[model samples]
Target: MLRLIMLATAGLLLGGCLQEEPAFPNVDLHGRLVVDQEVTGARQAQGIQGEYYKRVLSVNGQDMAFNDFVRHYCPDSNTRNETCIKAFRIKKIDDVSGATRFLPNGL
Candidate 1:
């Protein structure tokens, strides 16, 4: 009887675990953005016209606009510096509008 009770308890626990929702439901939106340092005056004098940086939003390797990424992920833009490395995990993407809904994970 004790063995049967233990088995039932274990089964109940496992069932609960199985039914629980994932931390990021439906889609696992995880990616990194690597922003490079600003070009110095000397570099610009040598004909560097614009900022040199790499922006990547790897939503299953799908490409996203830099502006959209910044708007959604980088809320506190004032604190941003030349060099930045940020990791982001969004909650879900709108199926129809393609809008990104992010989790409360801070920058």
Candidate 2:
């Protein structure tokens, strides 16, 4: 029957869709910055100095090198004029030992 064939096709399509893996893994490594930012100047700079953006409410991915994590998430801008993104939690992957460490901010 046409109806039976359509149902089978629909079932196969749904099954295939369901079997697809997520593009980004759902994970919160619960990590924070290891070092604190140094504040020396204006209100804008001071605003960024406080031990904020160190909370591990959410994280992006699973495996990442420490240096890579720093380069990606660490705030290096001194101007502080432009609207910048607050750092997110990063689970740094150790290069030497291949160890996973979650550095929680002791704010």
Candidate 3:
């Protein structure tokens, strides 16, 4: 009898844990950025360009905003150094239109 009761409780708990469907439908969006870093020499009053972040594989598979993705995943430091993360795949999410795209990086 105790085993039966335990089983029933477990089933109920599992059922409650199930997540509800999102009100806003999700979709994927894909794009790329030609990243370049420019530095201003205060003394020289001239701008020097550093090695630009290239071929940044961008995808919206997890449905994160552009800015959010940059902050959470592709931080500015990462862009500058490319050492924050060697490789990552993001689920693209469009804020205004509500679209989704998954562009996993091969690198």
20-70, model 2: which lDDT tens digit per residue? 322333333334334222322342475734332222323365555344444
Which lDDT tens digits does candidate 1 get at residues 1-107?
A: 99999999999999888632213212223434343354334456798665443444543356764445545544454433221223222212222222233435553
How does model 1 score by TM-score? 0.23
Q: Estimate each model's TM-score.
A: 0.23, 0.28, 0.28
Give the per-residue lDDT of model 3 (tens digit) for 1-107: 99999999999999999854323222222445443233123322455333322223344445343454445544444343232233223322222222233334642
lDDT of each: 0.43, 0.39, 0.40
Error of 1 at 27 (Å): 11
Q: What is the C-alpha RMSD of each candidate to the true structure, in Å?
A: 14.6, 13.8, 11.6
97: Cα error in model 1, Å: 34
Ranking according to TM-score, highest score first? 2, 3, 1
Q: CA lDDT of 103 in candidate 2?
A: 38
Q: Could you tell me the lDDT of residue 52 within candidate 1?
A: 43
Off by over 4 Å in 3: 15-30, 34-47, 50-107
List runs of model 1 lying over 4 Å from the truth: 15-50, 58-107
